[model samples]
Target: SADYQKILKDGGFVISMSGKGNCYDNAMVETVFKTLKAEIIWRTIFLSRLEAEIAIGRYIDGFYNPVRRHSALGYRSPCDFEAAA
Candidate 1:
């Protein structure tokens, strides 16, 4: 934990806490960012900002929502999870 804090400090990332009662503030947003960096940003080299934007849009519409496997949903995509429900 100390090493993580040191890395954040070196990176100039200021860690902030949620309000006292709102326990889930930014949790989902952080998870999405982590997944996006791992699955797309780290793997791709785009020629332009517009190209990267389009690719991210496509990834969200074409894969992440309807097709990407969610382990918490028994490894099913959102579409399949909804269908089963």
Candidate 2:
């Protein structure tokens, strides 16, 4: 299909594993998803989809991007790591 072919071409320079069922292949990403679900989704029951969207947006952009410390990035937030670089 054109979509599949185009995706392959577009991702020529990217390092991504093809297919699924390989948990160890994307460990860091899986960990982040798990943490988000545990901290945000499981902790609160949103009355509306829009409310949940807004809350997640704020959590990631306002809190996670600037203040959340990541072990992979030398215990610094993504914003701090980027600023240092």
Candidate 3:
């Protein structure tokens, strides 16, 4: 628990997996994964796992990180949010 305490003291943010008893804790993350699965992974049949990897990599590096507007970040793309900071 020392590392957890140190992280808390340093104001470091960490994501934790939901405990089996705590459904609410993973709700948002689960929702996002549901969206990802529904919209991207489940929608198409790829020739191989490598193709899926490339598609997701490109989605994150080329589109999602730099261009997609996130409502939680005041509707700014992650790159825009970091640039302002």
Candidate 4:
């Protein structure tokens, strides 16, 4: 919607380069979702939305950001890559 576009623009966030349903602009995000599902989501059953949120937060903060290595980051975790930069 135009209002959403305006909100994003006002926040200095760029909208997708392509139209909806086009995955080219968000391939990396899609990959992350896939991995998140495979690694944390599919294996766990959450009793509530808050539980899921907490689990995801821990997965990203305690492990993914600080420990999981990525090939794009030369096999270093995001925290390590950012520090090296």
Among these predictions, the greatest lDDT belongs to 4
Encode model 1's per-residue lDDT on 1-85: one tens digit a residue: 7899889989999977767777479777778899999999999999999999999999988999899998878999878999999
1 against 2, candidate with superior lDDT: 1
Alpha-carbon deviation at 31 in model 1, angstroms: 1.0
Candidate topping TM-score:
4
**1-85: candidate 3 lDDT, tens digit per residue:** 7788678768965645555789788776776677667867888788999999998888778877798887878999889999999
TM-score of 3: 0.64
* Residues 2-84, model 4: lDDT tens digits: 99889999999977678878887798899889989999999999999999999999999999999999998999999999999
Taking the candidates one at a time, how many backbone clashes does each contain? Answer: 0, 0, 0, 0
The order by descending lDDT is: 4, 1, 2, 3
At residue 79, candidate 4 shows an lDDT of 100
Task: Score every model by TM-score.
Answer: 0.63, 0.81, 0.64, 0.86
Candidate that beats the other on TM-score, 3 or 4, i.e. the better one: 4
Give every collision pair in model 3.
none
lDDT value for candidate 4? 0.93
lDDT of 2 by residue, 1-85 (tens): 6687678889885545667687888888898889789889899999999999999888899988899999999999999999999
Output the better candidate (1/4) by lDDT: 4
Give the deviation of candidate 1 from the true structure as CA RMSD.
10.8
